[model samples]
Target: MVLFLYSPLVSRGVAQSPLGAPRATLAAPAEASFAVGQQLDANLAAATAPLLAQGPSSGSIVTYIAMLSSQNVVPNAPMTEARGVVGAALAGDRLVVRGSFRELSSALRDYATDPVDPPNPNITSAFHIHRGSPSENGPFQYALEVTMNSTGRGGSATGDYRLTPEQIQALQNGLLYVDLHTTRNRGGELRGILMPA
Candidate 1:
């Protein structure tokens, strides 16, 4: 009679029987290991590949830069030496505006000699993207509105205005312009056309 005994160690690739007799150990399958390595390499390549090479994807970001000047204001303000840069970006559902001013008057005075009080002191001014030229009157549509920082030098604002596809096209076509309004000049203190950056 032949007696056969099974050992856990032998099943796990050990080269010895339960009675300590030598046996040939089985090697791990090389093809299976190579397949695992190939799968890992493919996953890594997919993760690092660029999504967009030509331009931004839909709902991606579009940026514009504006050079602000009082001379561009509708009804043009007095030739003050105030000038600034206003940057805007549309990303997803949000619109962001950032700006910095130099040689700007912080006083609560308008273009006229009259001294006026601002409704909100923290907001030194207001910025807007208008549908028409800064000089155009009536039926003005605001594309975006941002409150100036309290420092009167610069600030930023962001909002979810859900810009429409037509609005985005208008922005790209130069049909949009930035208008800045201060306590003194309610219509606009500074103005500039938006252009791609």
Candidate 2:
């Protein structure tokens, strides 16, 4: 019976324990198209010139933000405290992906993604934006570039790359999703859907 009381972990929240409390990752900038825990300030001047410049006149544009969590991963990821939030917006011909995260098990692999309804996929390099539904896994379609960090089991990912009109639509329709891959879980550790806000 004493052996049954034994445990692999020192206990949750113990500093020396491997599965201890989560550490802080880089903070995601507050001034983005959208974000977690807060909404854009109600002010006209808040609209940055660069974002406004890429308005509808500059072809189709998309701005989205969502919370990432372990629950969203398809086939389910091993239980982890890993979580984060992501925001995206168009800048010129480039699409920027930015997010802050914490509690990853190890170094990140690829930030896999899925986009719906794009014909002739071209994204073969950089981190990819893939095509899939909330309940499905799909192929990569667009590219993104961002540095990932894991100091203290947390960091941020930021990248920019060109996106297509059809890809933008996938985001709008909530048919696309973003996920983070880690060394321990190459498939995905955290996932978030691009549903309309």
Candidate 3:
């Protein structure tokens, strides 16, 4: 019976918290939300086009943040209870989606440019993906998993999420993105938005 309101960056600039909104169970239709250059969509293609057009902005990181939510349902499990990872990567030009693990898995990433020197390496993080969801109780909502890397595999330093070389290339060229990888019948889904970490 809680309600959460959002400005949706694309909608307006209202920085309000979307905490208590109705959700749907996997038993219901699965919905997805995506973030492109400026528009959000329910379709995957709508999310990829923007990346292709702007190649991660050279030594820069861009994130197509996806928010998955449900309608009329409550959460029966913890965010960690879900099995497997629910996202993909497109190396430079290739597109990959829905990589799995077990239940539902979430991931975040930071994209940095290749270092140029020892002092101020040219390689620096262009973008970052941080897990924004709180670890508390609430209705089912979209859990963010996976992030794009501009630097190919082996170029990463911190550990949490990993991307293949191909995936890194794809992200650099605006090809990689995260998608739903849930195996349950929950109603909440993913909504994406391209923004700064």
Candidate 4:
């Protein structure tokens, strides 16, 4: 009588050892796929393309865009229906700011004084870029200082300043913001967060 012993490994198609006994092969450990990571990287590149495109060929550049509004101001200052668009571009080490305003309060125009004035009241409305968010009330290091027109209905400003890498990174991370200041509200009448374009 002949008796045959069958091993489970042999049934699963595992190879036999030198002694004719089936051997089990260890399975590889599972790893997280890199496909998801690659997708996330692509998405981030797409979102930041507009801002990075402003950079100069010799060096890096970053761009920030903002919408001027009263509701974004710190301490919640009330303002007229004035609104504007602000654009800031940092190329190499130079930072450039530009913006246009509209529907500004008449009080701002009244407060604004010409340089010829005897007292020379410098109450001109101006634009500024602060280091922190709208709620944080950080220091204003870059000033656009755009003067309003006679109508107080519209104005524009352009200014440039030197910026370090840290400051540029802050701007890229949304840690910077723009503010519109008037003589009536020296603390800033309107504010907006700067974001990548």
Candidate 5:
């Protein structure tokens, strides 16, 4: 790389020519002018807002990073060798769970954001988040939206959900699990406790 010093201005307002000669002093450019004070807009504020809860309860914000495997399946599908990872974020009463799941023993089906069919056809996820510990099967709580290909869905899952105070505590306490339902094992082909990625 070649750096040709064409003309660099000295701090004293004198211009130094490339030939190592000093030129006449040049007036500094005027400062830039603005109409307004450059106030922040709503979108900028919303985008830059901190994700974690703020204030005296800020310490309660929790992040869960964990994995899901056949080993974590409550009933134990020994024949299946599927695995998954969960990443979750809890800010105040809002929680979003997202993860990737693969290597299932059978075809995936019926993934959703809720147990009942979503009112809007646009909601096309079938993954289920249950309120259970590793040792037991719990009721379905939230549904994760997953993608579909020529094959069955459940290859990946993501969903943002509003939660109650109790639900928030349960999630922080590691009492929530992701349930992957396949055609063969309707109960749950694979399971992983959710934390955020």
Candidate 6:
């Protein structure tokens, strides 16, 4: 009995003793709309010319500062705090798909799950949320998004595309819903909203 016990123990020890810890493959974080975790003091001012062009109203400046700073803040609890995909304002004609993730596994989850409501029939490209989904209210316009590409900080999206403008006299109105896509899955997600530029 003693020999058998010792043999098992020795085998277990050998099994535990490996050459080294297994090395995990790390995927790069998605490209950020702007530099994240970065202070918007000088760099931010230099980067956003559109904001600069709007003139120096205090409210405008304050809003711009808030927008830049909020990129680093954590989101409120109960959202997909786990590593997942993130979106950035649709810039130019293309949308960039990005995420703030520590590992590739986190970023990929967004792509696998049913993120789009009414279940996007065509998930071959970016997914879309249904117009009747709980997110929409009577006449308010919501932004629509689509993931086009990715990089190190996060990604980009194109949206707020006006299919039709809300006319004051019209009874029916349309709003934009946010949407996203994934290029490569990152294993984690970040906490925040990516507003349009």
The TM-scores of all predictions, comma-separated, are: 0.50, 0.59, 0.21, 0.59, 0.59, 0.27
TM-score of 5: 0.59
lDDT of 5: 0.54
Q: What global local distance difference test value does model 2 have?
A: 0.53
Compared with the true structure, all predictions reach lDDT values of 0.47, 0.53, 0.28, 0.56, 0.54, 0.26
CA lDDT of 59 in candidate 3?
24
Which lDDT value does model 1 have at 86? 55
Instruction: Enumerate residue pairs that collide in model 4.
Output: none
- lDDT-wise, the better of 1 and 3 is 1
RMSD, model 4, all Cα superposed? 22.4
TM-score of 1: 0.50
Worst lDDT 10-window in candidate 2: 39-48
lDDT of 2 by residue, 1-197 (tens): 11122112212121122223332322555432222342211111121233555555654434555567778788875687777766565444555566666777776653235322352445332234567887887776554444555364666655555657777667667766777767676677888775432
Off by over 4 Å in 6: 1-47, 54-61, 64-104, 109-115, 120-188, 193-197
In order of listing, the candidates' clash counts read 1, 7, 61, 0, 14, 36
* Shift in Å, residue 82, candidate 1: 1.9
Deviation (Å) of 187 in candidate 2:
0.6
Candidate 5's displacement at residue 46, Å, is 17
Off by over 4 Å in 5: 1-61, 111-125, 149-154, 195-197
